[model samples]
Target: MDQEDPGFSAVGEVAGDRVTVRVSGEVDMATADAMFRAATPGRVRAATLDLRAVTFFDSAAIHTLVRLADHYPGALKVFPSDRVRRVLDISGLGHQPWVSADQG
Candidate 1:
């Protein structure tokens, strides 16, 4: 989904100390900023980003996640798929502690 396509969107929820971000369709540069802010739920000891619904990801998405992790330090837990994981790995964002959604 592209910017002009207008079918992409991001939704989020938080349970306890973990935040769950569920994204649908493409998450490109244009949509990253809003998604990042939407996913972020202020100061939490742990964050569980649920990416099971994200159909696409790009550097912007990866960078956004990294920035959040950097901001919070050792308090970011990401749940991403293979495509999303590739972005995180390439961007060195996967080094952060990752906790399974079910674990929380």
Candidate 2:
């Protein structure tokens, strides 16, 4: 029997250098790469990651975000859920470009 596990469905919208990515499914080591690949390239002024629809997240996902922030200084923004924020906070990248979901 062949059983395949379907993964996350991330929707990304890009306008100019600003990109908004909405992740609805679990963000684990398996799926984090796709999200990073989907992000807008070349130093965007703003990047909004809407995780309001996300139900689960992991260290790899947080690592992805840290990489993005390091990838684009003063150009990466993350609109993370409270749960997500905790991860960012622990990673010490929360205060930089991170914004609360309701604020945006």
Question: In candidate 1, what are the lDDT values of residues 9-93, reduced to their tens digit?
Answer: 6666777876667666677788887777766768555555667667788888777877777765777666776677666677776
Question: Roughly what TM-score does model 1 have, to 2 decimal places?
Answer: 0.71
Global fold similarity of model 2 (TM-score): 0.76
Instruction: List model 2 lDDT by residue over 6-101, tens digit each.
Output: 657667788987888887777877778877877755556667778766666789888888787776677766777777777667777677645564
RMSD to the native, candidate 1? 3.6
Clashes of each: 0, 0
Best by lDDT: 2
- What TM-score fits each model? 0.71, 0.76
Off by over 4 Å in 1: 1-5, 42-45, 99-104
Q: Global CA lDDT of candidate 1, please?
A: 0.68
> How many pairs in model 2 have backbone atoms within 3 A of each other, for residues 3 or more apart or on separate chains, i.e. clashes?
0
